[model samples]
Target: MDTDRVRLCFYRLLQLFSTCAAFSLVASLGTGMGAVSHWSMFIWCFCFVITLITFIVQLGEYQPSLPFSGKSFLFTYACLATAFCLSASIMYAITYIQFLPHGPFRDQAAAAAAFSCIACVLYALEGAFLWLLFPETTFYFATIHGLFKLLETSVACIIFAFISNTSLHQHQPALVWCVAVYSICFTLGAVAMLLKLVKFESRLHTFFPHFLLGQTMLSVLLYASALVLWPLYQFNEEFGGQPQRSSDVSCSDELPSTLCIWDQKLTVAILTAINLLIHVADMAYWIHFIFIRSRASAITGL
Candidate 1:
């Protein structure tokens, strides 16, 4: 078996594993019991284990090629491995802490804050990689994307801070405000990044249909899913309570609760569909990059 083929196979396997892990995490949210939600944890652990194994195998088998040194590749592998470990550990700790007998809201908020911080770090590293790989052309785009990610994560951090400080569990208005703001910012950033990608395309429009366009589609789907989930979570938080009406309530004074209109089942179904669509788009992008795009690049040496 050729080493290159083996490496490619491992890469594809890793991608599949990552896709499964993402889906598992989203699915776990729908489970009623928190303990039963550990399936997502197991999926994450499995991904890390496979990633380590793949790294070791590829390191031993592959020889250095031009454009980057073996040492640089090893450094990248180390950073990625460390980031994944940190993310998993923090997530597990947060989950475990959330189940404590006298757990405070701050504990849950801390977990989210920690996750957001780590995500920002990972995004920084990823942006650095893109800059290094495509210095002249990709640097500006990478910088813009990284800035947007930082802003997005910062919003999460702010929400976490508020959750930690305030009685967030009881503050329905605050929770709604946080979710709405976060969703809007995320959507706008995603759109900006997509536009950047579109503006960068040259003459390969017909061949690739713009790589960023597919990414934009995925981003829009994700944004829509987030919007749907935001209000649904708010509805869940407010359900079974005396319906709070705003100052603009009509003279009837018998208006139906907003929760009734927010339909959890429909929201969950739409989110799930969007998730599946994003996964499909991800697969298509990966296939196009690995096979068609790369092969064409090699042939044309462009």
Candidate 2:
């Protein structure tokens, strides 16, 4: 009815359409494309369902009945959808589209990738619109710390997807350790985000900040170890791993049906390094907050 609501509705509709189109394309392919296709399908379907539910809740004015703030829920979900859909698009393109021969399959995969990308952009726009149009609240994800937590979780999800093939980590104890590190950090990050979402942080004072600082420090150390170990175990010749991508048959061959172990290993290693950097940055922020900013605030009585 109002302009803001109207705009919101428009964005939701576009997101729904794009996600639907993307998934439909994937579904039409009938599962021949392998893990990437299934992963892409899951992302698209998840986004579509969540968007539909959020749209319905907003339209029906059911915010009061919900456990969380509806605006915060929508904004957070939009950010998540954008990250997931973007990853899905990229994964689908990298694993399938580039390898598929020129044919109907290739066209369908490309179309799905395009639609996924469109949906990702729409969700980003929706999140931005909500942020700009509404007054800022104390939503945890809106803060820099919260956003970094979300990024860490999202990147972990992508790494998980890439490493879904057991061949990359199977029989390799070091790579398994990297997976454990990812799991630990991802679990901690998700729990932190959920606590903030449920407003549990407000109930605690110094403990939560201290918890965050500890969590980040632990995450940094874990990821740093994983960053070095993953590449070392994956690329080192002495480890029975290929020294170059071209040396790996799956990666060197053209038009492979699925992503090669080399690619997955490299992707996991690269993402591990990126997440290591993110954790480092997060650690620095928490250290500064716990030591400098909080002390200054207490001293000034602000």
- Cα-based TM-score, every candidate: 0.33, 0.92
lDDT winner among the candidates?
2
Tens-digit per-residue lDDT, 178-281, candidate 2: 88999999998888877777777778876988988888899998998998888888899898777898888877666688788788888888888888888889
**Tens-digit lDDT string for candidate 1 (1-302):** 67544544454354435534443443443443233124324434554565556456555765443233433333333333334434444443444334334445435434433543443354345435534544455332334333333334333322332233233233555344544544554455455444434443345544434454454455546555555544454444444322332422321335321212222223333443443344445445445655786688789985
Q: Give stretches of model 2 more than 4 Å off.
A: none
Question: How displaced is residue 192 in candidate 1, in Å?
Answer: 16
* lDDT accuracy of residue 82 in candidate 2: 89
Candidate 2, position 119, lDDT: 95
lDDT of 1: 0.41
User: Candidate 2's C-alpha lDDT?
Assistant: 0.85
Candidate lDDT values, in order: 0.41, 0.85
